[model samples]
Target chain A: MARKIVLIGPQRLQPTLAATVESLGVAGRIAAVTAGWEEREGEDRELHEHLGGRTTNLEAWTRVEDVMSADGELTGMIRQRADRLRAAHELYRLRLAHALDAARELLKREPQAGFEDLLEAEREAALRAVRVVDASHLERVSAIHAEFGAEAQPARRTSIRKHRAELEAQLKPCELLCIAGGHVVVLLHRLALLDVLGLWGERRPIVAWSAGAMALAERVVLFHDDPPQGAGNAEVYEPGLAAYSGLVPLPHARRRLRLHDGVRVGLMARRFAPDRCVALDALTRVEWDGSAWRGEAGTQQLDRQGHLTEVRS
Target chain B: MSGFVAELEQEARRGHHALEAFLRGRRFPVVDGRSVTFVWRGEADEVLLRHWIHGLPGGLPFHRVPGAGLWFLAIDVPEGSRVEYKIEVARWGERRLMADPLNEHHAADPYGANSVVHAQGYAPPEWIAHDAEARAGELREHAVRSQAYGGERRVQVYLPARFRTTRRYPLLVVHDGEDYLRFAALKTVLDNLIHRLELPSMVVALTQSPNRLEEYADDPRQARFLVDELVPELERAYPLVQKPAARGMMGASFGAVASLSAAWRHQGVFGNLLLQSGSFVFTDIGQHDRGPLFDPVVRFVNAFRRNPGRPAEHIYLSCGVYESLIYYNRSLMPLLSKSGMTVRFSESHDGHNWENWRDRLREGLSWLFPGPLWMVYE
Candidate 1:
């Protein structure tokens, strides 16, 4: 059976997770994941209260560490993946900066021949260059994941098998999975490593908020229009679990995006065109009901035309 | 002779009643130039007006009108001064704070209230009063199920008198909608503003949150419900301008946070924002003594300060100089401006309340929704 997944923005002031669980009628115990907190993962007392004490932490990070201690080759392979990913990100960062600068510069400059069509065509071409760079970076990251998956699973390290078995056992009695927010990359890493997504899809409802919400998207795009240093660009950090597609969850959007600038707002909408961009603030809940997306009253989406509109189910 | 004597007593009683009515009839504390006269009738050996004026201690005591059961006080004050005071009714050596019953206007604080006195050139606009000649807007109530909140909530929509389906109108959404309507006299203000062509004919939707504290605090589900459910319903029911720039969200205190949060999440939906005395409690800055209840608010503000996004195309942020949240709101202004958002900020010599928010509507709404004539003139 297909599972129900709800994504939201940040959950600081108003938490809808507990209410969401009750609404879903999942009265049984929930398997929880808070590996994003890193060292502070055990801090689930407040969360447990919200869930009526029907939650248990999966501790996937601890399991990952155990696996690394047990298996030398797998640990080495993991380190290699991390090093390569860093290098790829560093290289992509430089290219992306140059590509974006060129695009903006082209848009601002007047045509040498004074033909309006020439300027339009060149501007389109410049934008395409940025897309190309983005696409290329994604491909390299995808290849790395595929290679790791192909080699690691067949080897079947003892620690990995033990952890997988233990995870399945812990999840067996739980009727649902609740994901909390912290560090997006760390959360994503733990969830992916433990195969929690695969396990939950088979049975049980999935309710996630904040960073958890970001991890459900097709691609996790890190964006902050106004940063301490200066204007920042939106970058595709990593691929998401793709539990929910064609939806970009922008959490703490008030603190991040430059929605006032039509050029920037429109470009962002166009950059991820065909896919709708939704603001995932607190008390914001969107559920994929096996067909269409349903949401609350104030949930807004960036339309394909680069304008913001209220999202309807 | 005995019957005639009884008739004379009845006549005297009627005359005294008339005199009492006449004295209470006129607008209290009549102002002319710098001299203001306060009048009160019906027994009290000593009636004192306790005011916060410089060089006045224990208030100016009222003198009894000999053989009239009336107490009157006349004092000279500076022109263009607005004063808030309470009447101290002293009887049997006991004093009690009381509002001037004759004065229709009053300033309110969290602790009870006080009578308001506006000197010459310091009064609120006349347009705030309901005019018989003006056509009033109609308010329609609606209740819709929100998947974000997983419950049903009420939405009150205000349509201008000349609302027509043939044309699309801009949308103005307000949080704590009922409080604004009752306390701020929002409906009356809107009617006058629209009638005098101060602002455009707009469709205002006042949304009520089930859990105002929970819903207003940088919550994502609140944004989701606003955008996905409530908006779609509104769009279907009304002829609205289907663009972000034609829409706005407004609120006071936490409601301000909700307004900004909704706009921030869905910038494409709401292009304009009016925030009044927003509770942007930041731990990195000033005192955050609100404890756990404000933890999320602080976290959200901290995160925003770290990266203040330009959510709306035009933002009007107003704060009271006397409010505890003033420092935080002032600090937030720079971050918002730096986001490249066209920000207009103003401060008033007031505190966090509905009146402060009401006073701001004229400026905020006019600027955000300036009609054809204002656009051309300005």
Candidate 2:
């Protein structure tokens, strides 16, 4: 998470992109795109009037039909899904960074010896916990990393004066850049941010929307298929981090859904795989005040597609 | 409530049929049982089966008119519908159906539950569906919160009965918390079994040592974390019996050795030993005194080889007869038999999977508690 860049959500990102167009913001220099939704469909997603620690809400979802153009809605759906996966990956990496921090902190407690002492009994005491894969698969993971090939590194450290001079040259600071629909660009941006952060050891705010959102995690397994009605993607899940943690970033949810006309929840349920969620309607995001991540209104939440009922009125 | 459609008891017996109470009141016993051949235009869900015998507690156990066990009391409903309901055994006496074995949300009390046919199908809570979708989005949350490694498989929290703000409970420390949560179905079992009053009111901390090998072997750091970190954290959150005898340690395979060794090393902390499918041959590590592998559980079994005032009062050791490690499982059985450690052993048809372990969990909990009725200890 390069705090310099953040994407709010698809709808919010749309308006933010517009705002960027007017004021030449961080995302203004770079193009904003989305794979899950077409231009029209992507435009329909709204921006949150507010932001905070609240969770995925039911009121924030915009139907795929409403978001994308009629002719290219299907393609838009595929892109949206890919975008989500990549965004999830970015989020996972951000979390890994946090877990590494926590794991490091545990070392302080058991400074005398092995890491076994650092693994809190409470970690194991959690009656409700899940084991992803084991150490046996470490080699496979390494191979997967190798398959991706060695990524290029950022510029190295210069003299203190030179570094300060470069910082002075780069006077314009980093701001949050949110994107929706653009799966590849979004993922590229996340990778770029992660690498930049690793090189400089700096933390920045990042809020991504839709595909951009899903790209924030560890690995983005693409789920790009033509949705019958809506503009969204089918997501496959994988492991990324150790605990439930992250800065809460809220995304505005849209009203009404398209694909399956409203039955996508069940499809999303069975297909979302392990450690994943569809988070309809509302989704928010927030900042961390050291200890825990807190959310404010409209910041982050999985908006529910309100339960259907027959009303007395 | 209008959003909630009801679910009726669906029997699938060979030659019986179901009758809905609502339909019964509306129409005649349309499909009479006496009629050799009967035909009715009814949706499977619409017909609620009532198995009512004449003189029973809830007048249950009678057959439906034209259906059998495993039949669905279906209704003409759309695929996206959510509903809930139960069966009403409307007969003339005290004999009532125990409860639907298939239904996870069953009666808290099997012996006595009002036979009010609740016709509601399985409708997951709002949070479940939200989190179900949000489960994907929340990955960042789980990954950061946990210290395991890359990601989280699942989160399994065991909320014991007395684990409210009012009372305290002891810890029945366990390893491989993930397997216990997924395969063992500890929460569901604890909920139902406790309702049945089978096990004692204690907390079992099903855990997993990220460093499984060393933790299961002779790793003091792993042991210290469980005792110093895990124990106190659980003590803060849950209710515990607290005393050494009241506390226990249990596991299978490496976990089995870990449990026994943990108790052995910290004798006064853990007294009860539940070793299942343990590999105690010591052939792999034959040189290191073979003690770390075999000493703890064996010491608990022999109690210093001279009945040392029974260090552990309750001990349960079980394993599949056809298991790869049956030698270790069986050899220790006879050795453990000497102390009359309130043992009950059996051979089941399943191999080494969660299924076998799940079956054993119920039996083990029952043996531990024995309920207020079958008080073996007293």
Worst 10-residue lDDT window, candidate 2 chain A? A52-61
Query: So what's the TM-score on candidate 1?
Result: 0.45
What lDDT does each candidate get?
0.77, 0.39
lDDT of 2 by residue, A1-313 (tens): 3233333334432234444223323331222223233223233233322322111211111222222233253334335545654565455444333433342333234434565644554333221121222111223443433333333211232222233344333322433333343323323333332232232233433444545554444433333222111122322233221112232111222322232332333222222223233332233333332334434344422222312211110
Give one digit per residue, the lDDT tens place, for model 1 in A1-313: 5677877656546777788888899989999888775556776788888889999899876778777778888888878888888898879888988888777676557677758898878778877888788888888888887787777762266777777788888898999888887667778877887787776654567888777877778887777665322236777777888887777777766545666665666666666766777877667778885556887788877653346677787
Off by over 4 Å in 1: A105-123, A304-306, B1-378
- Residue range B48-167, candidate 1, lDDT tens digits: 988754345757787665566766677765675566678888888888778988888897644567787776767675667897645799999988788988978789999987777766
Residue B92's lDDT in candidate 1: 83
TM for chain B in all models? Answer: 0.74, 0.50
Candidate 2 regions with alpha-carbon error over 4 angstroms: A1-313, B1-157, B283-311, B337-344, B372-378
